[model samples]
Target: MKKLLTMFITFFKIGAFTFGGGYAMIPLIEAEVVDKQNWIDKEEFLDIIVISQSFPGALAVNSSVFIGYKIGGLIGAVLALMGVVLPSFFIILIVAHFFLQFRNNHIVDLLFKGISAAVPVLVLSGIDKLAKSLDKSVDNLIILIISIVAVTIFNIHPILIISFAAIYGILFLRKKVD
Candidate 1:
């Protein structure tokens, strides 16, 4: 019970203050879940992030639910998800009303522009952390390179890219006798 409450409160604070939306939520999650609470290890957190990205819905919300479930089951999942989203929902509703009226304000526009730029940087940092933990073998590098090239040049959908990588890994690198 106390653990669930802590999760809810901690995520509520993170979700309430974080700007720039889902990508920006990564750092907050890392600090709380990894550094503070030790609810999930870094590898598990990264896997959860990857899994969340491969699906639909908001990535941050999905991650919160996943971590919460891992910690304290269904009830915890509900608490964490509600903690993360509810404040943002209400704040958006209020801010959207004000924002329309102040749409032409230069300061507001510039603030948003700055935040939009930073969101990508934050997301990239999360990716960098994930990459550092991965085995940087030649085959893995090749798969990563192929995935990037296909996405950049051919605009392959992410699902197809992941599928191709999986198939390649299975066919070429099935566990062989050491």
Candidate 2:
């Protein structure tokens, strides 16, 4: 019961304070779940990030549910999800009510512009962290290059790229021992 409450409060704080999207929440999640609570190690956290991204939902919510389940089962998952979602839900409701009034305000425009500028930095920080953790093996490098090219030049969907990479890994990257 205590642990469930803690999870709810922690995720509520994260959801309430985080300005940008999932990428922006990574550092905060890491600090709380990995560093402060010691629920999972860094490698496990990285795995959670990867798994969260691979799925369809928002990364922050997915990760919170994952961690909550790991800590306290199905009820915990529900609690954590509720915790993270409630803040955004209420904020959006309040903002929606007043946003039209402020839509033409220059100060509000400037504030949004500043927030937009900062979002990329937060996203980049997440990319840097993920990059540092990636194994620099030749096959992995090839896959990375292919994924970049496919996304940037060919404008391919990321899901297709990830699927190809998974198939490639299974078919050609398998290890054999005598």
Candidate 3:
């Protein structure tokens, strides 16, 4: 009961306040869950993030639900998900209700301008989290470099990039000379 309330409110706060979306929320989640509340350790948090990324669905919400469940079982997952998403859901509803009329407002414009500036920071944080989570190895490094170069320079379809990577690994990395 008490834990459920805590879960809802904490996620509610996260959903309500943070400026950026999933990536931005990562740092905030770390602060609240890892540093402040001690709900999860860094490794668990990272593992949850990884699992969330691998599966289909929203990353932050999925990770929060998993963490919440770990902490307080089924009820915890429900509460954490609510905490994480309720604010965004409501805000989107309210914003959608009036967004067209509000779009031209000077205050709203400035607010969006401010929010746009935060996106790069959010991306950096997301990258940092991924770096921390992934195993450090030459193969990983090479794959990262090739992916970046292919995406940035060639502007290839993502599917092609994934396919090539998969094929490269299967043909070369997986085979051993016996």
Largest lDDT belongs to which candidate? 2
Model 3 misplaced regions, further than 4 Å: 129-134, 153-178
Give the least accurate 10-residue stretch of model 1, judged by summed lDDT. 169-178
lDDT value, residue 139 of candidate 3:
85
lDDT of 1 by residue, 47-155 (tens): 8887777677888899999999998999999999999998899898999889888899999899889988887888787677778877779898998998999999999
**Residue 17 C-alpha lDDT in model 3:** 86
Q: Which has the higher lDDT value, candidate number 2 or candidate number 3?
A: 2
Error of 2 at 44 (Å): 0.8
**Candidate 3 residue lDDT tens string, 12-64:** 89889876777778877887888888988888888787667655678789888
Candidate 1 Cα errors over 4 Å, as ranges: 169-178
The lDDT, on a scale of 0 to 1, for candidate 1 is 0.86
Off by over 4 Å in 2: 174-178
- Every model's TM-score: 0.87, 0.92, 0.79
Screening candidate 1 with a backbone cut-off below 3 angstroms (N, C-alpha, C), the clashing residue pairs are: none
Model 3, backbone clash pairs (residues 3+ apart or across chains), number? 1
Better by TM-score, candidate 3 or 1? 1
Query: For model 3, which pairs clash?
Result: 11-83
Residue 25, model 3, lDDT:
83
Candidate 1 vs 3: which has more lDDT = 1
